[model samples]
Target: MAFLPTTKEEMQEQGYEQVDFIYVLGDAYVDHPSFGCAIITRTLQAFGYSCAILAQPDWHKDEEFLQFGTPRLGFLVSAGNIDSMVNHYSVNKRRRDQDAYSDDGIMGKRPDRPTIVYTQILKRLFPDVPVLIGGIEASLRRLAHYDYWDDKVRRSILIDSQADLLMFGMGENTIVEVADALNSGLAVQDICYIRGTVWKSKTLDMIVDDYILLPSYEQVRTDKRAYAKSFMIQYENQDAINSKMLIEAYEGWYVICNQPPLPLTQEQMDFTYSLPYERTFHPKYHYVPAIEEVQFSITSNRGCFGACAFCAITSHQGRVISTRSVESVVAEAKTITQMKNFKGYIHDVGGPSANFSRPACDKQQTHGACAKRQCLWPTPCPNLKVDHSHYVDMLDQVRALPNVKKVFIRSGIRYDYLMYDKDETFFDRLVQHHISGQLKVAPEHVSAPVLDKMGKPRKELYLRFVDRYYEKNKQFGKKQFLVPYLMSSHPGCDLNSAIELACYLKKIHHTPKQVQDFYPTPGTLATCMYYTGLDPRNMKPVYVAKTYEEKLEQRALMQFSYPKNYEIVYRALKKAHREDLIGNGPKCLIPKNKPKQNASFKQERAHRQKRYSKT
Candidate 1:
């Protein structure tokens, strides 16, 4: 299989006068399954449709969009694998210096909100052509969402981009269905019946299925409570077996989102991964940093059942688990061994939650996930089946393959879920085989109030898991460590809560190198709480650290060991009446007195000040 045509010359070389769809992207094209565009385009090709690549075209040039001479069916636009705003800026709203998705880690290759920019330009260039948008940016923003960068509620991306149709979720099936409909000459406006799609409607007259009317755009934009209510409704209705059509009204029109498409079965998953991907970036680029991590990685599954409050997987991929057969995975591993740059290692063989290899329970397959309940949060549901035998067997087969050295499960392991399983066969094997020096796990916070707000397990559960993990390592006679991912400044986390987390870190004897402040991105329950100061699950007012200084203090408290953070941590501890943690005792996070500046450093500082004064 050759790379897809990216230029007019390549299209001619492929003996095409025109292509069926021009896939406009916001990132450098890397034909790997880790990329959403590659999967969608390859799936279309498998169903006998032609697609031309338009990877990271110049947004300022009208001629760039006209290179393909207009797509026959329509134009497919995606803001790459990541949200454009997130790709361009950090949580602090600072412009990022490097873009891994661009050539050679260069920044500013694509415009911010490329889906809106590209679609608007396409509409201007070819007024009658259809424009379809999907990927993380479009999927999460399919409905009215709170934009952290804008600090305001923005209308649905479907409405803002003026796209004829928006496909959400893992769009393998949705894209083909829409492509078939378009190939059959159905108009874009009339193609609203497909699942996993959001389209604008002037009226709800043609709607026959049962539907729920969400709070209108005006209501959600004006009232925070209304926004929270709307988000909760959307959250509950993500399952395919039971979800209903959702309609959000605007002043002159309505945005109708059909129920999500069913998750891929084992056979379908096998076929999707079996597509003839070139498995590397297009030769046009010198390097793409994003491909390094995923080049040797294999996505064994799709969707996540552990719906963390701060994650967008439930909103996009739903809670149902779809996995490839062990045979399929082994076949991919064998293919990797044959590559020219093949090493003896397979980077990863996991997905969203590594150990989640099947549905939460039998009822989830038939009746759909419970709307108001969680599978593993608070406590594991009684009906939740705890089995890692299949995952163990799969790993066993992969590692046994020829030319394979070690298969690591780099994608997180849900410790609470792992602890629930009485059978220790998988746990024993995991400690024996998968540890690449350190196993990374997310214990977002230790405070019960903060953990509840973050939808994470309590401190006791995490401590128990940690104890068991170390015991396993001791039994295996391996010197492995646990790298716990921590977050600070989440909703319900006050100054005292931050101090509690700092004390817990002191008890654990681990200092995290990086501490992520709670980022309020769209399509998350945590973000809703951050914006509304109320948990959508229960309309109770929650304490939120909104100011810059407070958030900085919370972050500093997590990494209180660093000398640079001593002042901030000291101020935070004092503010929380935690002067007890400021002494030179074993439990103290910082020393009583600040470190004195050396004579040479003081002289250098004074010299710089003097020079500035003279100037």
Candidate 2:
């Protein structure tokens, strides 16, 4: 019902001389469950701990972090909901102009690498206080991994940030357990046995559980093969039910990662969301751009089973599906209907994957996700459950609520998973009810070789889904269309593969308005491939589009219809020895001769060149 204290006066208003924890953030404060800071702080408050928010404090001034003085428990730090570097720079390494998490969509509100920066400031100001770091940035970088921004292998963030403890995964359970230990007078260094956490040690004598010793940092940093091998081991050990502790050696210390925290039960999931949240950004700011997309949206589930190679969700949230009850989801939707800004519309009602309302199979409950297999990748495993009845029922109850005119599912849906379901009831309802004129699904790429590296299904599967989608729309007399999300310049994507994608686009007579170049962020299988030119799953050489020109040409192939990209597409076709694609024929992606560039086209080209030239 009330926002957490953000200032000394508010701390006093809460009748606290000093708070237990100062939760530092790199984003503007928003008291919505969609934001991680809100959930963690509110969860702590629910456990009878007083916490304050220090949102986007000036890192240069030591006094800025000392606003609440030292806390009784310690400090909690997060680099917003995303990695600070990824939030600041695009895949091309060009600085972005707008930051959706900042006040009024402003840029440069927080320094780059805010976790390391903030931790260092806090450590310097209060040398004895403990600093616990988590979020997407720290969770993915908890081991020896490749950093695309640095273009080198970097040590674990716990080592780099010098934080006392690092909590990984969805840390609701992990945070509370850690808090209990600290409150019981345990030293940060000795609190190393908890699941879903990473800690440092001077020797391995303290490691009582069975653990796999990974290749040392020196080995992974110098040898790409060692890096790939190490990543595969870490990737396979993300399961809670069957994983062992992992240790990676450095010069004089070792970073130890415990097995992931177990997935929350349905009751626990509901209780976490049921906590009191103001559900908006702090009133001090006029507006926060990130809240607009999630204000009326509901998160019905957590974790993703679709272990895409380019995604880090599997590494962070784990592969087991954890969901809220249908009653909980309906309760939240009813709350949205009563808001002052309610427009009789609910924006989204899904999570990592919208339709994943239950575990992949009954076996996942007893045993964690298969270590050597993915639930829906290469092909849906024989044991895959492939049910959507619960999801359909949930949506039906939500839309039937009073004052709710429309409900849209904006989260990306795994089309391959949808196609696997034997029943067509969910598919038909999705097309007829949930779509907001256009539905977005990620096909990633069309080429078989590229799709293999991206961990996506074959193009035939997508084509089938597309055909069925159109059929459902026709049955309902609706004009909905599928907006397939495509990626370019991914690992294993050569010029020929790019040409193949262009030809496929020509066959469909569709062009994407915007295309995403594969971003090599930290701790993704795709990033390992981008850095080492080898797939971690199998130690096989893979084609990586690394050079600026090659990446540009690959991206141009996706938007071949643009006149400004005519030259780049032509060059790509010639480079691939596919000159047949250049002509007046219907299948040609470009013309034989260069097209005249208008002023706007020239300006856009010049701007792009200027932007990419920095990287």
Candidate 3:
């Protein structure tokens, strides 16, 4: 269980003349199973492939990449846990001051586009060596899509980076298969049949028949409608069983993405987590801030059935929920209690959605998710099963373990799904034990049209959840608050819709402390809408707040209680022809300050003119 070799000295000590794979990461090396890099490198080690870490290498030159003297198999590149662009910049396109994934939480350790930069560096240094890219950055940008920072349609990362292959989703199965094939002396270009991966082919002869050909890169780049159309096709084919081989044409090459790898079963999920992870950052690094949040947490499940338009979980983790058994989760919890800095508290016991320990329904396992229909949207499907007793039992078991003080569920859950369940046992216990005063929930928006476009349930559903949450709090005699996470300037949200949301916030007597302006990152349905100005589902025209000022105005309206935000909220209301909202009435968002301010300004100007005339 020694750490992977990161330096030439370590490699020499380990007698590794040439490692099988050299993983170049954007973030500091944290050899925990929660990190994709750790799981991938550990899996390779399990398969007897020697892997070394070249984490956060300086991209200015290729000298830093030669530390391992070229990997025998290939070079694995990832932008750490988050996309590099997202890790480096905020939604406003401003450089972030801190990167939690870095040692000491410093910024600028990695370039803005780390995967492309590192891949280019490796390719230049070692012309014969193959480069493979995965992780969130490469996965979401595996195909040609919108770049929020560049504000243009960029080509696939595989083309830009010239990497041999792009492993898209969770790459446990794909990376192992890739390592084995490369070990067997298979050429990188010829290893095209692996699932959950994208590879470049020069000719159509390599492409299998009956594949759904997406709109060419040239087509999507030039035509907005084509981009939206292409997104819809890509969206529907995310299921493993029902997915077809997707082919997209470039100028002289074709990017062929194989069907996604099958989801891990319960046993497989347990085995994946059972790896001998140090469960901490590499000891060489003095401090890794990102580990503070998840070091004590456990990921009980993966994937999400609640497919929100703004989220990429459905694309990245798939729609089917794969969970570890209760025994495995409890064992992990016990191991956490024995950690050096154990505080007797487990931060989280969930994944994409905490409460989603099971599939949406029984048919999802065998039939695949309904192509056109959603499990939780419009309304919870009649076939949707909403059992939570298994999750409750698991939580109870972990809480009762020796040396365990309290188990908390900090990861977010689907409030609507909780409401759908006829059994309220988990809901009751959640309020009683799990929460820490204020529970953060994402309602996103309150306007029906905006909610519908965002793939969220209607306002009434959230309201009911709110009522019950507070009622449960009252019953427990614990004064807890519901901190609703709201978003502004999402696709399909105009000034009118923003005003509607502002009015709703007024009725609730709650001003959000934070309001996120929708950032159109790659591979989300909302991002497609943001770039195309049309809903991919029906190709309907959707209102998008494309201007920086308009986005600011919408965000200001969400937290209009701040004195600095009054002017923007007032202007937004005026522009939307809702001058009625500018008064002293209860329904008014802001007072008619200009009415008195203009008169004072005229009087002061008259006095100044009279004084100037006398002088």
Worst 10 residues of 1 by lDDT: 606-615
- Give one digit per residue, the lDDT tens place, for model 2 in 359-399: 99999999888999988889889999989988999999999
Estimate, for each residue in 1-615, the C-alpha lDDT of model 1 and write its tens digit.
Answer: 998899999999998999999999999999999999999999999999999999999999989999889789999999999998988887778777799999999998899999999999998898899999999999999999999999999999999999999999999999999999999999998998999999998898999999999999999999999999999999999999889999999989899999998999999999999999999999999999999888888898878888688899988888989989999998998888889998888899889999999999989888988998899888888899998987888899999988888988898899988999999998999999987999999999888899999889888888899899999999999999999998888899999989988898898788888888888888999999999999999899999999999999999988888766889998988888889988999988999998765688678879877865664
In candidate 1, stretches whose alpha carbon ends up further than 4 angstroms from where it belongs are 596-615
Clashing pairs in 2: none
RMSD to native, candidate 3? 5.9
Model 3, runs deviating above 4 Å: 594-615
At residue 590, candidate 1 shows an lDDT of: 93
lDDT of 1: 0.91
- Compared with the true structure, what per-residue lDDT tens digits does model 3 show for residues 1-615? 798898989988998888999999999999887899999998888888998899998887567888789789899999999988888888977777789999999888899889999999888888899899999999898889999999999999999999999998888889999998999999998889899999998898856546999999999999999999999999999998888989899999999988888888999899889888999998888899999889999999999989799999888989999999999999899889999899889998989899998999999899888888899998888999998887998899999999888888888979999998889999998998888778988889988999999889999899999999999999989898888889999998988889999899888898887778898899999999999999999999999998889999999988776666778888888788999988899988888773333566568779877865664
Query: Which candidate comes out best when scored by TM-score?
Result: 2
lDDT of each: 0.91, 0.92, 0.89
RMSD of each: 2.9, 1.4, 5.9
**Candidate 3's error at 613, in angstroms?**
41
* Ordering by TM-score: 2, 1, 3
Q: Global CA lDDT of candidate 2, please?
A: 0.92
